[model samples]
Target: MKAIIAGTTMPVLELTLDAGERIIAEGGDVSWLTPGFDIQTSTAFGSGGRGGFMSGLKRMVGGGQLFLTQYTAQAPGSFVAFAAQLPGTIRELAIDPQDQFMVQSGAYMASTPDVEVSVGLQKKLGAGIFGGAGVVFQKLAGNGTAWVQLAGEIVEYDLQAGQSLLIHPGHLALYRAEMPLEFASIKGIKNKFFGDSLFLAQLHGPGHVWLQSMTPAKLAAAIEPYLPEKSSSDNN
Candidate 1:
């Protein structure tokens, strides 16, 4: 299968498959497709082996589908496309046996059949429980290419050994497995105004990190005021 990411600012992943090739993606991400393709939903696993019911539940909490959708091409010249939810960029990463990436929860889009998507957990309780950032994430592993979407614009930084960067939790998009990540407390009165010790993601890296200009949480907050307010009568 040959894949190309077309467009910027709301990019879409277009895949052209040869006979018998397949691709898997998250549920609700499908935009369009061509003939000679079969879409199947499986709760076990997307790549190979078995991920039982319990595993599927865990994956759902990690921000993926309980059942994944697979598109298999029955003949050559078949095609499929998946679109990102937000106005941002779609990125492709090649995964080798020695490489694994920690994707922001809900950021994964699609992947070649050889890739496996699973959960990644943050060991730190500060970010996991106290902070609003997610503790579970979609872990992309195996030897294949995986696609992910970042909200709004994307920024990348390569940090040398012992180098660190502090970022708001909502802005983190993706980071390499080797990078050190933890939550740090914001000192002083700003925490009181915000309702808690405003936490930041402290990334100490000898690897790469990606940040997004817009996050779902931030976007919702921005537009919350314009949304219809709940009325007392509606509670009935």
Candidate 2:
């Protein structure tokens, strides 16, 4: 299978598959597809393995869909497309036994059949509470290619073993699964008006980290004041 990301802001993933080629993704992620494809919806593992029920439950609790959808090409030249939910970039990463990643909630889109996505739980309560995406992020493992959507522009950093970066939770997009994350309180800083906490996410790494310029929550907050309010009549 071949994957190409098209467009600028709000990019789309277009996948071209040969006969019998397959791709797996969370249910409801497909924006469009051509004819001559066999689609299966199930709770089974992306690799067509066992433990459908337990895996499904874990995925749902991790802010992912309970069912996964598999798309198979009936013949060569078949194609399927998935669009980014926000105005952002769609990135394709190569995954393998030695390379894995953890992604924030709503960042993952689709992957090859051999890839697996599971819950990546934060170790500390402080990191869980202030991380914006909660304790459970999506862990992408196994051996294949995976596609992810990140809001706005993407910035990449390759950190040395002892190097670290303090980040606002919402800006943390994706990172190497082996990286360690902790929370730090900003001294002398208080956000009483906006209800933001002084805590920030500190990620320590000997690996790569990707940060996004925008987040859904922050975008919503920026537009909330401009949105029309419901009237008393609409409530009825």
Using lDDT as the measure, which candidate wins? 2
Clashes of each: 0, 0
Candidate 1 lDDT over residue span 51-127, tens digit each: 66765676776768888888889989899998878899988898876777888888989888777787775444343
CA lDDT, candidate 2, residue 178? 94
Residue 118 accuracy (lDDT) in model 2: 75
TM-score of candidate 2 on Cα atoms, chains taken together: 0.91
The TM-score, computed over Cα atoms with residue i paired to residue i, of candidate 1 is: 0.87
lDDT of 2 by residue, 126-212 (tens): 433544435457888888899999999999999999999998777999999999988776766665523455667899979999999
What is the lDDT for 229 in model 1? 88
Could you tell me every candidate's TM-score relative to the true structure? 0.87, 0.91
Best candidate according to TM-score: 2
What range of 10 consecutive residues in model 1 has the weakest lDDT sum? 122-131
